[model samples]
Target: MADVACEISARGFLNSLLREWTGWSLAPAAEAEMEAGPGDGRLRIPLPSRGSVVEIAVVHRSSVGLHVFRLPFREHRAGAPARIMAFAEFAAAVAHEPAIVGPEAARAAPAFLGRVFQSLSAIEDALARAPAPGLGLHADPSFQEAERALRFGHAVHPTPRSRDGFTPEDARTFAPEYGRGFPLRWWSAAPDAIVQGTSRAETAADLSAGLAAEDPALDRRIPAAAEGRVLLPMHPWQAARLTLDPAVDALFRSSQLIDHGSGGSPWFATTSLRSLYAPHARVMLKHSLSLRLTNSLRLIKPVECARGLAVDALLQGSVGAAIAARWPRFHILGEPGYLALRGADGAVLPQTIVALRDNPFRGSGQRPAAVLAALCEIDPDGRGSALADTILRIAEREGGGAQGAETVALRWFGSFLDLVVGPLLGMQCAFGLLFGAHQQNLVLGLDDGWPAEAFFRDCQGTGFVREFLPVLAEAAPGLDLGSGHRFTAAEAARIMAYYLIVNSVFAVIGAIAIAGLAREAVLIRQLRRFVEALAGTDLPDKTCLRLLLDAPTLGSKGNFMICFRNINENTDVTDPLAHYAGLPNPLAVAPAEVRP
Candidate 1:
């Protein structure tokens, strides 16, 4: 158990280090100074401040430059023969001095390490439990299992499972990995106190009532509340935290906000911890969690909430209908409405806000849709990834072996591009809208283990270009599509490329390589061929395509740097494209010929 814990911690630390190294463009000249003998993965890094060199053995090296190293140096201070420490310890030993490393990083190191350790502990706890049966996607899989199957939250993120505000008990109950379901804490809000962002329904009360109708128990609970008041559901954690706010407290005291407490059909926490899946209800509820998860607090900001409705309204128009007609397989899980409590001063209670999301996997035609992140996730039990497992099955049916696996991999990758990448590009080029098509936000529908359809979620991270504002306004008037989230052509191109190409497509290829199903080089060639063919089309925005084909480096989000700087991701920057650093563009490199 201790060894497993240590291993987990080391992996987290190495991921952090890799992000810092690559994202910050750290001097590789220093790394080149060390020499590794033939078949030797050992390297000695000089620690000038410590006046010593730390010897490390390479455990694993990712194609994206994430290298996990096991420290094998003796502890001189402790007088131990040999000691093993994670990257955090090694970073402290070499770069703790304020002069050596920046003051911000020096201060943030302890907090970052603490989160990494917490994440490691959580992952260890998750892995200790018996591996869930068959990738949680059998002939007919439960939605909860598909959600829980994403044991590790983020692929490239350093502390993907870290929940700073959560206690051990809270994690056991609310974390997706535990597969625990609990009733949401309910609140009865006066009609005057309720704020509706934008809804197809007549009023805010109607929206709340509509949501309640999904669950019979919840519906029953609503009428039992104070007369003329609407029932609003809240995450228990958020409900508890809201008590600290003076405005919310005032509302509670005035009886404007009646706490009905937790009672209703239980909702299971999805992979994105804040979103809850109500299996019986066939609706997903995204609540505002004040608790920090990954980069930011999982709260639905006012602008973001508005953006959801704006997106929904836009998608209901002629342009949206055209998109649907062109690419029927591509679906957007719309956030049709949002509800929140407003104080006497017209201030929104952020903690009380919740967005109503569409659940595509409720009934027939639901067809096993696996979150792309979950599909890429490596099973701790060495059973391989859901994606690899699915592909392997297909390969076995076609004729088993390395050659068969490669053939299946190629076919799957091609199909994945047509279903996912093609539609995403079309949306961006034609509509000037870009979906945040990262692995987590994308759900790929599988037809007998082959990619058939793609569904995208999360409106908050979606991007729109300024150049297309007039066109959008003409298409959908009266909608506040202008949330100041506009991006320039270059900015939109970079952001889209980073999310779709670097994060989604490249990450999947890396996963395939790690699974030993196919080489990354082959996958890269396949991606290039697909893009080159697309480039020949008469597309509106060739910026992304041109950049992908011509650019020497691609933008990559700096998660480690973001943590080190302690930036509030919500309001830190006006331009999100600035959050990324230049990374080597694999697509631009000389393409390998496809195997005949």
Candidate 2:
């Protein structure tokens, strides 16, 4: 716990807090807002109950919500010196402002603030630690190195690092910022008690057993459990937490599931925290965590595991080949197999679910792959980002100075638009497949900081357009992903636009702008042109593209509301719209130019 008075990155913290605060209001809102004040580069936000207003000095502003403000936020009264307030004080006042949160923010304030403090402390810790792999040493940095570089977490999100269920020590040991790795705790389950699924002919048992054999420690202990037992690998944290559950204990007593103790080549935590990666291992393991991080429980449900296998099926069929041939630079990181244990009543245990994801970075073949979120994140210390560094490095290599740098940034962003946006839009318009192409899930294979290929992961967030079901069926007969995977054209439009345009593409624009490489509107203009060129093509379901080009407002994730309402995005299956709020479209504001 941090003292409310104790602060780290006060200006940066306040900027992020207020950004999320007013940004939420830009969409359909409960109360908080920023009123443009007399064209003086100031934002005047009123606190109705307190009868005072907060004034912020805008430095770098964006038509989108990515505004950077000058320090020392002043609270103005009817007759006061505009009292300068601390970040915590400002956060507290905003939280209690009923006009903004309708009294709900007051109740949720402490839980939210406590997590914010934890996140801030984590950032401070990350800043002090040296780059784990000696980052610049490797010509092509490992995938884990890029994952570790996301010290600040989500760009527009508050409490990006608050691991609610973790202790400070646990946060240091398990969180990606710390660059921690641990041996997995092994387990063996009777084949009857194990529920398994795979896209290929190989059984989960066969995969797990083969992986276990690679680890001599687990390999030696496996035979003792039983000759016919199925082996499973679990995160040390998940294994420890699950061992405390009564149901798990009961199963242990009955010999249905036996613990083989901890052993394996050490696996490091990735940006997602719950997902573990090992360079030597053939697969990355995505474990089900009970803790709430961000808007959802990190636990993997059977449905989510099933979704990954379905993706593998799609990738194996003609549909996959066509998508591959169309967008050679795009990749899908699908889970080939998954394993979970069943309870006494034959119910799947959520905590026991483990997903085996394909690891291209395995062995000596590690690539300079990083999620877009990491590359775009601004250093709270005002040192810019890995992306900025990459752009500048490229500029230097090409014998360029200050003016030349902007040109490099522009060209770099254009490649990103091609490699990322092209395939994502193609997936939507042509195939009627919608990927959760959020920044964190979209990893770019970088060549000297230039995006070369797109690797989209987490198949759980995928959706199929019902209108294109017949097309999908004919092309990929292997995709029978069942209910919830199918969505109406309207639902697909909202999801595709929100994920591809709002979350993923917008982050790149923000990064380039925030780094001072280019103006926000300039990048927005380029984006508009990119969309214009794509929409000119012959693809079906141009709804998302049209919305990008014409919609006054688009749907955005209401991160503030989700935290205040205590909604779990993963489990909130009924009202998926709860995650959405209205966001002013930057494309609407950026002036479009007449092209020859």
Candidate 3:
């Protein structure tokens, strides 16, 4: 009993002190063998659930044995006890709650004893297998000379300590709305905060109200309160580094969506607030894609988004910049942009990722017609002007410079095709449609109320199968699919399905959705007209051609619809002319692979 208490007390001190300060928790106790003998043993306590497993080794001085405490994965899956408490604070808490140790604990201890002893058996087995002294060129160590020993390996470990190194100067300031739940160091009297719900509305409201009543100098009006909704301001550098302009900053300060859309509810439709600062500060505020239309969708995880943004910022700043010279309106913001946030855990929030838009798209409303008119008004003579030069270059290089509308469409399609199948595919499996032809990813350069240039934005949404696997492995190495460092082919296939069917397809759908909501017929009419013009004289099916040409409509493959599109066998096999027949897709399931 004395030995058990001593072991437990030593472990309890570490768990209740050092580990707690470092945001670590003690797993249920486990048994470990100290040496090959039956009496040599101790208990081990595991750290809390983190990306990696950290074990606390406790040695039983008398028994000279070791036991490891590990919460069974099954138990963790079932219900593991976890508390984010401070060491000093929680020690006081435990002292006050002595009832925490009870008959239930006694019962739990015996179960842990069985597990600990089992582990000790394995340790003893290992020690027994150690090589005899003088087995190799050198004899065992001085200490090992008294006993048989095996080769030794080295390891590194961090000593557990408090996260108290965080100071007021290190305090990362964020807008009140985004401040909840984030760890912060403050000089003020009242600074501790915890988010009770995932709703941005509730969090923002509480934060705004709290700040207004507390701080007098700071202007609360920065957060626009519309329909009881507040736009929460967040720091950009922590999770992602997206570039933006002053206009985007102002947009972040002034914009507010009707806060009903839940976090990561992919289908939740709401307004978008964009501000860019690539060339100059340009702000765009629009009400669209909110809870009414978007509740069914799932947003990608934030870590996944961070990876994409890093890739984009790196690529666009280098190789992409060289090619982007032709598309002058496509701008890259040089610094990170602020964000509005709402979500639980590390989930992606339904917030804008601001960047500099040198020339912004006039969303499907009034400004589009002007852009279209500008495209038409360009000099037909094909001399001077960058636009004409590009068109001529396309004519000379691609399809024998097919003239008129055919030449333009062919050039556009050919450029898009080359980008996707070439550079885009070379990276890894990516998500967003390689070319977000829709207004969402596209912007028109305006020269005197006319569209003189066209560009694509949201490059971060672009994805590759190869780029993601390493990141995924780093986060969870067990998920690695063998074949060394690269992702297994099976993993690649899954990513391909997600990229093509979910990300790319849905982007197209979003474009279409924006189009369908047109208050004026001009947007749709001009689109149809452009399609007709592009398809002139070519006897291709106009419906199919329009479907392929119209950017927004082509991009709308959202989640639910993707499940339907993901059918196994072309059940229409009997219809001899089924679309799936001889479709050379590697992802296509052989009739044999399908479930019987």
Candidate 4:
């Protein structure tokens, strides 16, 4: 089962890679060969520049246009051996292409392969364990179940599960998919050495006490000798690595920083592995780690931490109230505060930083909110998606059979648009606020297998138009809307289109189609109707909607190219919008039906 899951993920990676890199064209001759062949057939991708053609056996073709290919054969030369290797091997072999290889691929390949292995192991573990019953659709599903449900990571990313620094043991112990929890390592920072953002709590100690209130064991662990110091919690792995830092070492030697080792009740890892969740608590902790996951190192930069606090403050003010009035179901999981230790040179320590995130699912009365990514995940058994099964069950309850399923799917899609897309556009047009509403960053509140509410999280990717600075300033006085968080109107529009439209909305539509619940074209037409209605309104900035309707191509982040170039997603670039490549606009291709 794990092998099957890994292979499916590999095919997805290849499909995304081919789409992004190399102008791979279908050979006329290869099409003829496929037609002539019996049963399943092979397709060839002609790489003219490389003077090689790659052949793949078609396993399954998804309705959404994602091809699942197996038994890939790379023909380097006419007489050379047609090597049949695993997907990771094939990726490494192909990385030799100047167009595909990033400066860091050579350094990143080993780590990428290691992660693939870890992903397979994790998948095997999941399959061995008994499946959680009923798609976890109770009034409240276990947080750990939702977190672990994401066996496979980003479908489009070449190395979705790759973590550079972790061993197999570490992967099992730390990865969210493994469902293991461990105590956080504790440190003591002198009062003067603590750098923190303003929150309901006045000091780092105050925040620590608030966190400890959730678990009495945590409070008991605080030593009397640490009375004058701020309690600092760190990921155990991060703590072990910090010894190599000269500045941190010097601070430890000077008594400004004291290592208190691991203590406190275990905090479970969330889908975003660095973020930990205490189910009983009202807050989630986003901690900084040095390990590389997917495109970037999982460390929280000082600027990002500050931006989170600023965004949280902005959302709590008049701007937030205006948005809430417009769409009450659209919730932003605010990152209210953060704490970090400063070095002797006054530099903020990235590894020691922790951001406080709101926990919306604290009580039993709250509707079950599951990560959207988890819903889209392919079950290890390969029977169907959790989302598809849930939709089918709902359809059965409503009536029965395929027609009923289609009705439920269409209705669910419409509600998703109302709860998620409507608020996203409202925020952009009304407040000039752009949310990074990618699948992993969104949690959908589910009631009877339908999307009831949409919750957006992770403020690091959130942005605002520079034109709205005055409005934001008035709403949240003294808040620093950093230049990095500010975007031009055009930039904001493009980003909203990519994150909210291309990644989030289109992704959900595609997932629905791929699950065989409904047609992609129908869902897309529904989306078109929704956007058209919004465009007709007197909203200020409907550029995202207008662009989606009018643009020949839409901007999509080039994860393959970004990874190849070793682009640090955390680093501030002069042109942040340049990371995208043009993807054919689905809305433009499939026009909405003209109304009478």
Ranking 3 against 4 by lDDT, winner: 4
lDDT (C-alpha, whole model) for all candidates: 0.73, 0.75, 0.26, 0.72
Off by over 4 Å in 1: 22-46, 53-62, 65-83, 86-88, 91-101, 129-133, 136-142, 202-204, 218-221, 363-366, 381-383, 592-596
Error of 1 at 302 (Å): 0.7
Q: For residues 1-596, could you state the per-residue lDDT of candidate 1 as single tens digits? A: 44554544455454554544622222233352253322225444444555545565554445554344443333233345545555557646533634333566567767866777677777777777625546623442445566788876666666778887998788888888788889888788887898876646554456556556766666574556655787787888788889888889999999889887687778888889999887665457899887888788777888888888788888889878989999999999888777899988998877788888878877433577788877877655332677787788787777867789888888888899999999998888878997888988898887778877888999867778888889899998777877637887788889999899888887678667767777777788888888898889988778888899879888888776676566667767666777787777878876643342
In candidate 2, stretches whose alpha carbon ends up further than 4 angstroms from where it belongs are 1-40, 129-140, 216-219, 223-226, 589-596
TM-score of every prediction relative to native: 0.90, 0.91, 0.28, 0.89
Worst 10 residues of 2 by lDDT: 23-32
Instruction: Write candidate 2's Cα lDDT for 378-415 as tens digits.
Output: 65534366677778888887888988889999999999
Rank by TM-score (best first):
2, 1, 4, 3
- Candidate 4 local accuracy as lDDT? 0.72
| Residue-wise C-alpha lDDT for candidate 3, range 1-596, written one tens digit per residue | 22222222223233223311233333322343322122223222222222222233232221000111212111111245533332233222322221432234333433333322322322233233332222111211111111112111000001110011212222112111011112111111111111112112233234433433333333433323322343332222222221233323333344322221112101110111111111111221111111111111222223323433344344334344543553343443221222234322423244332221123322222222111111211111111122233344444544563344234433343343333322222222222113222222333333322233444444334433344445434443343223222333333333332333223322222222222221112222333343345446443223333333332222221221111122212121222112211111211222233231
Clash pairs detected, candidate 4: 102-564
Best by TM-score: 2
Q: How many residue pairs clash in each candidate at the backbone level?
A: 0, 4, 52, 1
> Cα-based RMSD of the predictions, in order?
3.8, 4.3, 29.5, 3.6
| Ranking, lDDT, top scorer first | 2, 1, 4, 3
Model 1 global lDDT (CA atoms, 0 to 1): 0.73
